[model samples]
Target: MRNVTDRIFQGAISVFIRKGLQATTQEVAKEAGVAEVTLYRRYSTKENLFITVIKNVLEKKFDSHVLEIAKENETEVFLMNIIEDRLEILSKNYDLVKMLLSESLRGNLANEINLPDIIFSSLKKGLEYHFELKNQTVDIDFCARQLGGIFLSYVVLPNAQPFNKLTLQEKKDIARKHAKAVLATI
Candidate 1:
C-alpha cells in the first residue's frame, strides 16, 4: 500500500511540476504506472492529490532533509546550515518550487491546504527556539519571515541579473550574508 502511495506521490510531484494544476489524472496515473481509476480511488479529486503531494512529499522532504538542525550546534553554524540546505534544495528543485509558488500565487490549490504556511511554520519555530537559547531578543517571527523572503527572492528571481549568474561559492556567500543580516538584528 505504501509503495503504491509513494509511486503515486512521486508521479504527482513530477507531473505537477511539469504541467502545473492543469496536469491530468491520466498523466499522473501513467507516470505512476497505475490505472487512472486507481488515482481516483486513492485521491478522490485533483486538489486532494495535489494537497497530498505538498503535505506528504514536499513538506516531508523539506522537514527531514532541509530543516533538520541539531540542538547542540552553534547558532551561526545552525544559520549557515539552514541557509545552505535551503539554497541547495531550492536550486535542485527549482522547477517544482517555481510551480508551487505559482500555484500559491494564483490561488489554484484549495485554501485549506495552505502550503506556504505549512512549510514555513517549522522554520519560524526553529528560529524562535534558537533565539531563546542564545538569549537573543530579536523579533523571532519577523526574522523568520525575513529569511523566508531571502529564499523566496532566489526562487522568484533566479534569473535576475547578476544573481542568476552567481557561482556556487557566490551562492554560499549570499547565504552567509543572509545569516549576517539576521544576526545584525540582534
Candidate 2:
C-alpha cells in the first residue's frame, strides 16, 4: 500500500512539474504505472491530487527542525546552516520552484501555494527569534529580504550552471559568503 501511494505521489510530482496543473490524471496514472482507478481511489479529483503533491513537496523541502536548530546555535552558525539548507532545498526543487515563481508573478497562485512566501517565512521567523535573543536592533525582515535575494540570484543565474550542479566546495563557499554578509549587516 505504501509503495503504491509513493509511486502515485512521485508520479504526480513528475507530471505536475512537467505540465503544471494542466496535467491529467491519466498522464499521472501512466507515469506511476498504476491504473486510473488507483489514482481515483486515493485522490478523487485532479485538484486534490495536486494539493497533496504540493503539500508533500513543501513538507519535504522545509525541514521541521531547522528553526529549532537555529534557536539553539550561535547566530553565525545558524545563519550558515540556514543558508546551506535553503540553498539545498531550492537547488533540489529548482524546476518546481521556478514554475511556481512564474505563475505566482502572473497572480495565478495564491499565498497558500506561493513557494517564496512559504520558504522565506520560516527563515525570517528564525532570524527574528535569533535577533531577539541577542537583543540586536537589526530589522529581521530586511535581513531576510537581502539574504533571500542573494541566495536566489546565485541559485537561478541564467546561462550559468544550476546551483545543484555546483561542486560541494562552491556551495559551501557561497553559504559562507552569505553568512558573512548577513553578519556584517548586524
Candidate 3:
C-alpha cells in the first residue's frame, strides 16, 4: 500500500514538474503504472492529489531537517544546518520548486501548499523552538523573513556557481558565512 502511494506521489511529481498545474490525473496514473481509477479512488481530485504530493515532498525534503536541526545547542550550528540542508534540497529540486513558485504566483495553488509560506513558517517554527529551548527571545519573525529571503533569492536569482554544482566543502563554507551574519543579526 505504501509502495503504491509512493509510486503515485513520484508520478505526480514528475508530471507536475513537467506540466505544472495543467497536468492531468490520467497522465499521473499512466506514469505511475496504475489505473486512473486508483488515483481518483485515493485522492478524489487532481487538486487534492497535488496538495498531498507537495506537502509530502516539502515535509520529506525540507521540514523534517529543520525540525531536527532546531535541536542543536548552538544557534550558529542550527543556522548552518538549516541553511545547508535547505539550499541543497532547493537546488536539487530547482525545477519543481520553480514550477510550484510559478503556479503559486499565478494563484493556482492553495495557501496550504504555497512554497514560500511553508518555507517561511518552517524556518520560523524552527527558530522559535530553538530559542524556547534556550529560554532566549529574539525577533523570530524578522529572522525567519531574513532566512526565507535568502532561500527564495537562490530560487529566483542567478548565482555565479549553482549550489548543486558546488562541492560539499564549498556548500559548508557558504552556510558558515551566512550563519555568522544571521547570528550577528539575531
Best by TM-score: 3
Question: Candidate 1 residues 41-91, lDDT tens each?
Answer: 988988888887877756665676433463535776777667767666766
* Candidate 3 per-residue lDDT over residues 85-173, each given as its tens digit: 88888999999999998998898999778787778878888899999998998999989888887888889999998798999899999
After superposition, candidate 3 runs with Cα above 4 Å error? none
- Single out the weakest 10-residue window by summed lDDT for candidate 3: 59-68
Comparing 1 with 3 on lDDT, the higher-scoring candidate is 3
Residue 49 local lDDT, model 2: 82
Q: For every candidate structure, what is the RMSD over all alpha carbons to the true structure, in angstroms?
A: 3.1, 2.4, 1.7
Error of 1 at 115 (Å): 3.6
Q: In model 2, which regions exceed 4 Å deviation?
A: 135-137
**lDDT, residue 85, candidate 1:** 71
Model 3 pairs in collision: none
**Model 3: lDDT of residue 3:** 92
Best to worst by TM-score, what's the order? 3, 1, 2
**Clash pairs of candidate 1?**
none
Query: Between which residue pairs do clashes occur in model 2?
Result: none
The per-model lDDT (C-alpha) reads 0.75, 0.78, 0.89
